[model samples]
Target: MSFQGEQYPGVKAPAAETDGFRLNHTMLRIKDPQAALDFYSRVFGMQVLRRLDFEEMQFSLYFLAKLEAGDEVPEDKARRSVWTFSQKGLLELTHNWGTEDQADFAYHDGNAEPQGFGHICFSVPDLDAAEAWFDANEVEFIKRSDQGKMPDVVFVKDVDGYWIEVVEAARMADKGD
Candidate 1:
């Protein structure tokens, strides 16, 4: 898997030296905060870790993550903010005000022409069960687990049509590829 393209020479940052560096979160713009929050919570079992509201700016940021069974979120605001920042694999949902009321408003889902951002993924315990649940809940599937080149994975859409890839974590581990 190689491609020929123009290359530029530049000094590389010392990524190896950054001891505490980690990918903290990925942001997705949503038109309706409630709808997006509901979809994520219901489908992915994610909980809101923290929320930042900017009234003057007319936008709110919701940080969500799938916490483990025994994990607890800090109750203190400052401590919770720090704890949230330190955690990896967070999803930040940004909702701009007034977009929900605009019937024709929508955010570019990054899957059509001029595509850049692709999709976010989740590893489930059971692929078959998850697919069945999605179908029962009336969730739209872009690709089913039994279809596509990667037959073991499924892709579903959110309220805003953002693609989410779901796969069986145990099966993926067994593949060992």
Candidate 2:
């Protein structure tokens, strides 16, 4: 028998209150920080919230977060160590000089699964519009020829060779119920 579905025959579910942990952000290693910043901004509508520079180490890191409706914090406030307000989820971008040799440019492929870790997914208001934007912007996406029946999904790569997934918000809302 395949260990796909029966791997945990008697696995017990967690408590109702302990459903799952909140997703922080996927950290990516990129060669060119500026290029990665431009890609995310143009394709995914993500904005750079804060930037931390390590001048001595010849490396810099940027924190990016999707600008959701009613989610706007002044840049000065975010630059500080901590703010009185809550922090929105952000994607951490790491750029290290001479560290690009360790970066992976190809899509991740694990085991017999055709799809690898894939990419960090975000639920958007409309998939069609987003897809169009990606196409117009010349973003490359992997074809899901045999991934079975799945919802509308598009893939884009960041400057550091990481894939990002985009999903529809309407479908996500239905799944909540």
Candidate 3:
């Protein structure tokens, strides 16, 4: 009875003209850029790809990603901006200028009572190892794999209280054709 096999009635197929379109990144508003950047780099091993600052607008955008071995990242900022947008699965953290200075500043983490955005996820090669690493890093856990019906998935909260689902890639269901 799972919806996985269902065709999602009334949903039309996307046009071939949209073939080149891609999901560049998901943006999350963070109070502190440095804290978020450090967390992503230290825990998720993401590197900042490009940073855009809008001074008059009083905000900044930072794009981050885990580049593979063969990926060629340009040294030029302009080229890097284009290259960053071309890749998929990048995480963008937006910071409104003075929010970090406000001691009580907080963003609605989507999982609260009026839920909207769910979560971002990462596929780790080893679930057990990831759990251990998270423990060592003192990552806050919403759900441990062994504690839930789903035994291979783990949910942890980031510095800003955004839930991030972690899973073992090998256990993911194949997209059957």
Listed per candidate, the RMSD to the true structure in angstroms reads: 5.2, 7.1, 3.8
Q: Ten consecutive residues with minimal summed lDDT in candidate 1?
A: 1-10
Off by over 4 Å in 2: 1-23, 75-81, 84-86, 98-117, 144-148, 172-177
Ranking by TM-score: 3, 1, 2
Whole-model Cα lDDT per candidate?
0.91, 0.65, 0.91
- TM-score for all predictions? 0.88, 0.67, 0.92
Indicate the residue-level lDDT of 48 in model 2: 76
lDDT of 3 by residue, 9-100 (tens): 78766688987999999999999998999899999999999999999999999999987899999999999999999999999999999999
Best of the candidates, TM-score: 3
Q: Which portions of model 1 show Cα errors greater than 4 Å?
A: 1-16, 173-177
What total of clashing residue pairs does each candidate reach?
0, 0, 0
lDDT of 1 at 117: 88
Error (Å) of candidate 1 at residue 11 is 13
Error of 2 at 133 (Å): 0.6
Tens-digit per-residue lDDT, 128-172, candidate 1: 999999998889999997787777889999999999989887777
Tens-place lDDT per residue, model 2, 1-177, is 344342366876556796545555666766777678889887778887777789998888787877768854665754443431235467877887666454554323321257556567777787777777777988877532124355455556555556666777665554432
